[model samples]
Target: MKKQMKILDAQDKELMTVRKIEREGNALIIRGKIFGAMPMVAKLTPAEARAAFSLLDMKTILFLLSFLFRR
Candidate 1:
């Protein structure tokens, strides 16, 4: 699976940049672009990436639960 995000400048310019963070086989792929040019990609460990996601999910779930239960 892959997740993507875009970075924008003050003028809301695309900045020719996109972040493609994905997992393929057993490796995590991190990609980025700058000024609509200069593409770069990197590989990361699954353990490292998933660890942050796990915490993020937990926080999201807690926030949702509290929101739903708020009076």
Candidate 2:
């Protein structure tokens, strides 16, 4: 069995498929298409994802957020 996850854009379109994801490892590798066209591959580390993505709540996520803001 192959473990995979779908990555969707803001408009709900399929952006990419996360074919291989190892959070505890050094990098997260993805294989999919762009704009439903050309094939593409990307590598992102945990550190990069944490700094660039605000929606991620991964293992080492920095919770700079405060509860007071969630009203």
Candidate 3:
């Protein structure tokens, strides 16, 4: 049996079906297994991806920060 996962890109685009997901310290390693071939592994952090696509609005930014940091 295999596990299924969704792979998202930097632009919030659904890239492909994630074949596997692994953790290396604080980063996530994603491997795509589509088209019967092994795709390249992409390593990223939640904060890094969010920062890369962060919005400019101060209020929205604050809201997002609060949401992310909330326990």
* Poorly placed runs, candidate 2 (over 4 Å): 1-4, 22-25, 53-71
Collision count for each candidate, in order: 1, 0, 0
Best by lDDT: 3
Per-residue alpha-carbon lDDT of candidate 2 for residues 1-71, written as tens digits (9 for 90 to 100): 77766779899988776566444468887676666677777888878878787766664344445534656
In model 1, the worst 10-residue window by lDDT is 13-22
**Once superposed on the true structure, which residue ranges of model 1 sit more than 4 Å away at CA?**
1-5, 9-16, 19-24, 54-71
As for model 1, its CA RMSD to the true structure in angstroms is: 7.0
TM-score of 3: 0.46
Q: Per TM-score, what order, best first? A: 3, 2, 1
Which lDDT tens digits does candidate 1 get at residues 1-71? Answer: 44556678899987645567778889977788777688988777878768867777676868977886788
The most accurate candidate by TM-score is 3
Off by over 4 Å in 3: 6-15, 34-38, 52-71
Instruction: Tell me how many residue pairs clash in candidate 2.
Output: 0
What is candidate 3's lDDT per residue for 1-71, written digit by digit as tens?
78876657798666678877899898999888654465667889989878767755787767888895788
The deviation in Å at residue 45 for candidate 1 is: 2.2
Q: How does residue 7 of candidate 1 score in lDDT?
A: 79
- Residue 24 of model 3: what lDDT? 89
